[model samples]
Target: MRYFLKRFGFMALTVFAVCALTFFLMNAIPGGTAELILKHTFVGLEESATEEQLNQISSRYNLDDPLYIQFFRWVKAAVTGEGIGTSYVFRKPVLYLLALRLPATIQLAGASMAIAVLAGVSLGIYSALRENRISDHILRVATLFGVSMPCFWVALLLILVFSLKLKLVPVAGYGSLENLFLPAAALSLHSMAAVMRVTRTSMLETLGQEYIRFAKAKGLPLRKIISRHALKNAMLPVVTVIGFQMGNLLGGTIVIEKIFAWPGIGSLLVDSISARDLPVVQGCVLAIVSMFLLVNFLVDMLYTHLDPRIRYG
Candidate 1:
């Protein structure tokens, strides 16, 4: 309980710092949503609109306030559950935009991580078991390629080979299992490579331990010895990597999401930035930071379960 509480306190502090930084950075930008809106709205009517009309519009949006005051008002609305107001570009509520896009992003991130964990662990185990063999050599080379490949290039290659050439999967858009495979594969490749290396190294170290040798000396079957003794210990490091990679997967889905035209938070973020929509950008950044922190907390809790040495205070 003490450990959990301490971590929770730290998380709260981290979140407040992130929020403050985000607010200040957004304000520090050259212009704001109000300025953009005013430019577009008063394009031809600059002479017709009286000073009162301009002041009314600016006051209505609270654009006339100081930067600190504006930030505090936004913070108040966010905490009070009063919605983050409409986007200056889209003219829709920020909360509404998030509600529509967040699920897709979550789904993409979850599927990518799941695939990376399963495939990477399996291959890593196989390579470790067959160390110095042809299979290990092949896997090592493949993992190197994966690690070296840029995600955007991988995404484009997959699009060309799978979507364009083979016509095996849909080229773009979200929804349906068929549409998910390429993007998920692209997202998982680099993570899978890291997992493979971690698993192989851990397994090699675990297999050389005295306990493993003793298990083998008991005339236990190779499968039983490896599964019951070696694999479990080897998995500790792999679990740690997976936990860290899950956070990366969430943040790094931007390229894959954009390539596939998936309606995820990454795509929304890109669009918001292009349109200079401050509220939407702030909300998206906050959501991502919160999710990443939550994931790390869960991963820490999981460590205690996965390894007996990781006891909570």
Candidate 2:
């Protein structure tokens, strides 16, 4: 309980700091903040939105107020769930726009993580059992390739082979399960390699332990020994990596979404930034930060279940 409370408090503080930083940084762009916002909001208007319109926007959002006051006001509005202000570009409620795009992002991230864990853990166990053999070396090389390549390149390569050459899946766009395959594979490759390496190293170490040797001496089945002893112990570090990678998946989705035209929060954030839609950008950053913090907290809670020796005091 104590640890949970402490973590919760820290998460709140982190969210506040992140939101404040994003807000201020956007306001500090080279051009005058008000002028840039006005230009983007009224690109269709003659003379970059008249002074009368600029005054209306500023007064309405209290943009002319000191930075601290503006920050607090926006924070209050956000917390109360009343509204997070309208988007300068979309002319829709920031929260509403986020709500629409969030599910797509969640779906993509969840699929990618699932692929990473299932494939990575299985391969890791296989490689560990083989150790220095030909198969193990091959997998190690493949993992190096996975980790060394950038995600955008991975994404394009997947598209080239799976989509363009084989016609196995659509080139891009999202709706059905087919649309998910390429992006998820692209997004997951790096994490999968990471998990595989960690799992293999941990498994090898665990297999060399006294308990494992004793279990072998007792004529225990190799399968039983591995399943009951080695795999469980090896999983601790793997779980930690998975938790950290889940947060990273969110950041990765930005590029993946844009490349695939997936219409997730990443694309929304990109568009908002380009248009100087401060409210939408702030809301997206807040949502991403909050989600990342919550995932880490949940992962911490999961430690007690994965290892009996862990205690959160």
Candidate 3:
């Protein structure tokens, strides 16, 4: 309970700080959402609209208000479940636009993380068990390659080979399970590499401990000793890495999303940024930050259960 409380308190403070910073940063950027809207809406009416007409549009969106007042209004609307106002670019409710696009992003992130955890852990354990063997050497080389490759380049290569030359998957735009494999594979590669390294390191250290030797001395089966004892201890650091990677997966999806035409939050952010859609940008940032913080908190709680020595300070 004490650990949970402390973590929750710290996360709350961090969320508040991030929210403030996001708000101020958005405000600091020159030109209001209203101006952006007018630029798009009144493309040929620059000379036709009177100064008063332009001021009216700005006032209608409350863009003329002080920055702090605008922020408070946005917060109030957000808290009261009034939605994320309207986007200057799309001319639709920001929340509605996000709702339309968020699932694709969530699917991408979830699939990537799942692949990373499973593949990474398996490779890590395999490498550890066969330490210094050819298999271990090959796995290490593969992991290093995965870690070294840039996500954009990987994405492009996958597109060029699988989608273009081989025709194994669709080239771009997401739909159905078939669309997920390539982007998920691209997103998970680096995370999988990191997990493999961590798992190998942890397992090696755990294998050296006296308890593992004791289990072996008892004539326990290799599988039982490794599964029940060695792997369990090695999982602590793996869990930490997995949790952090979940957050990274969300943020890192932007480039992959764009490349694949996946309609995830990262892509939405890019689109919103290009159009200067403040509400959409703000809402997406807040949502991503909240998710990142929530995952971290859950991982911290899991640490205590996974390892007895991990006590809350």
Best by lDDT: 2
Shift of residue 184 alpha carbon in model 2, Å: 0.5
Candidate 1 per-residue lDDT over residues 97-202, each given as its tens digit: 9999999999988888888989999899999999999999999999999889988899999999999999999899888999999999999999999999999999
Computed on alpha carbons, the lDDT of every model, listed in order, comes to: 0.84, 0.89, 0.86
Off by over 4 Å in 1: 38-57
Instruction: Looking at model 3, report the run of 10 residues with the lowest lDDT sum.
Output: 31-40
RMSD of each: 2.8, 1.7, 2.1
TM-score each candidate: 0.90, 0.95, 0.92
What's the candidate order when arranged by decreasing lDDT?
2, 3, 1
**Between 1 and 3, whose lDDT is larger?**
3
Whole-model alpha-carbon lDDT for candidate 3: 0.86
Clashing pairs in model 2, backbone N/Cα/C closer than 3 A: none
Better of 1 and 3 by TM-score: 3
Task: Estimate, for each residue in 247-310, the C-alpha lDDT of model 2 and write its tens digit.
Answer: 7788899999999999899999998888788899998998888888877788777788879999
Q: What is the lDDT of candidate 1?
A: 0.84
lDDT of 1 at 163: 90
Candidate 3 lDDT by residue in tens digits, 199-244: 9999999999999999999999989988999987899999999888
TM-score of 3: 0.92
Top of the candidates by TM-score? 2
